[model samples]
Structure formats: structure tokens, C-alpha cells
Target: MSRPQQVLASYRSLLRATRIAFDGDHRVFMAARQQVRQGYETGRTELTSEPEHYDEIDKRLEHASGVALLLRSNIVQGQLMHRKANEEPLSTGDHGIASQSDESVYKLRIHKHTELGDNDAVKGGKTSLAGTAKKIKWSNIDE
Candidate 1:
């Protein structure tokens, strides 16, 4: 089993690291400290001889450190650095009217649509609006 002194040292180290990284927030510092203490306390009665247990904790610490570093860098610049090239040109085509042809063209140049269309006027006769229209009276329905 790992020595009690080693366990206590690790618990304090974890708290210190977390507290420093999140010093600006009072709540975060206290929460991190409490969490570290609770974690060590939970395993206080159990043995710490397993290599995997310590390995998992080490990985968690490394991840937390990485996150802190990234946040610090972001706060300093006020913007995140993307992995891709800056201002990369995207593939785009010039705006133009579309046509149903299989061939591709920048512009479709048809002067007229068809021989007859909606603009040709009503074929039957002139339509009446106000003279033939009737006003509807609303009625209440019983529930």
C-alpha cells in the first residue's frame, strides 16, 4: 500500500494546483479543495496499492492542467486560435439565376418564359370584386 504521507501530499498538491488555476473565483477554489479532500477521505480506509488508481488520478491532473493552460491563453487573447489556416478561402461560385439544364452556366439568358402565362390576363371575362362579394356574419356556437 502507498504510504499515508504520499496520499496526503498528493491530495494537497491537487488542491493547490486547482486553487492556483482558478484563483479568480472564490466558489471554484473552495469546491476544488473540498472535492480533493473528499476524494482522499473516501479512500482513507481502503488500500492504495493498485497502480491503476494512481494512474487514473495522474491522467485527470494532466487533463485539468491542459484545460487551465488553454483557458489562460484564451483569456489573454480574447479569442481562440483555430487549428486551420487563418482566413482560408472557401470554394464558392458567383451568384446567378438557376436553370433546369444539365450544363452549367454562370447566367441563364432566356428573354421570355412561355407563349402564355399568368400575366396574359383572365381568358373568360373581366372579373367583378366589390359588386359580387358578400359580407359574412359571425355566429356564437354553444359549448
Candidate 2:
């Protein structure tokens, strides 16, 4: 529309973008707001005189809005990652939430011979690791 309106819209958009870019950091937003306002005031006369530059001004405002949107997306992604990291320790059986489905099947002999009777030499309980090893007299073999 009019040059004055266009200039005001751009100025306002710049302030809004600056506020978003800093997220909730008020100190930085205020500093950026002041600088943008001063810059807009100083350039007001020049913008009004150059009617042909309206298209270029619109493009620049559009670009600034896009950049702010991207910054907000980036901030959201970072927050998601932080939240995921915090949630991990509570899941995957780390914080005493062990998954019963993962019960180890390491007792192979017991599992394979679950039906064995008392007469069998295999035994009635789970096999120990040391029991799997047999000791032989190497001296007799050497003799």
C-alpha cells in the first residue's frame, strides 16, 4: 500500500522476529528491539522517497519472517532432544523398569532337559560355569 504503512509493517515485523529469535530471553529482545526501531526511524525518509524500492522492501520482510520461523523450529528441535534424553533413563529397563520379556535364556542345559528324571546324572538344578570344565591328569598322559 502506502510507503508509510509498508515501512511501519516492516519495522513491526523486525521487532517480532527479534523477540522470537531470542525465545524467552527478555534482555536480548529489548536490546534488539531498540536497535531495530532506531534503524527504522533513521531510514524512514529514504524509504518514503524511493517508491520503486517497495518491492525489494517486501521481499526483505518476507525473508526476515522466514528466518524467524526457522529459528523457532530449531529451538523446538533442541528442546525435543533434551526431553528425550531425560526420558530415556526412565525407560529401557534402566530405572528398575526391567522388561520381563528379556528374561535371559542362558540356562541352556536346564531348558533342553526340563523333563529329566531323578535317575539322570545331569542333576536337578541349573549348571554352574565351573561344572562345564573337566580336569585331566596331564602327567599321566606324558608318562
Every model's TM-score: 0.34, 0.38
Q: Give the distance in Å from residue 123's predicted Cα in candidate 2 to where it truly belongs.
A: 58
Q: Considering summed lDDT, which 10 consecutive residues are worst modelled in model 1?
A: 108-117
Task: Report the Cα lDDT for residue 118, model 1.
Answer: 35
Off by over 4 Å in 1: 48-143
Residues 28-55 of candidate 1 have per-residue lDDT tens digits of: 6688677766766666544355775676
lDDT of 1: 0.42
Q: lDDT of each structure?
A: 0.42, 0.46
Leading candidate by lDDT: 2
Off by over 4 Å in 2: 50-143
> What shift in Å separates residue 14 of candidate 2 from its native position after superposition?
1.9
Q: Model 1 Cα displacement at 65 (Å)?
A: 10
Clashing pairs in 1: none
Q: How far is 48's C-alpha from truth in model 1 (Å)? A: 6.7
What lDDT score goes with residue 133 in model 2?
Answer: 34
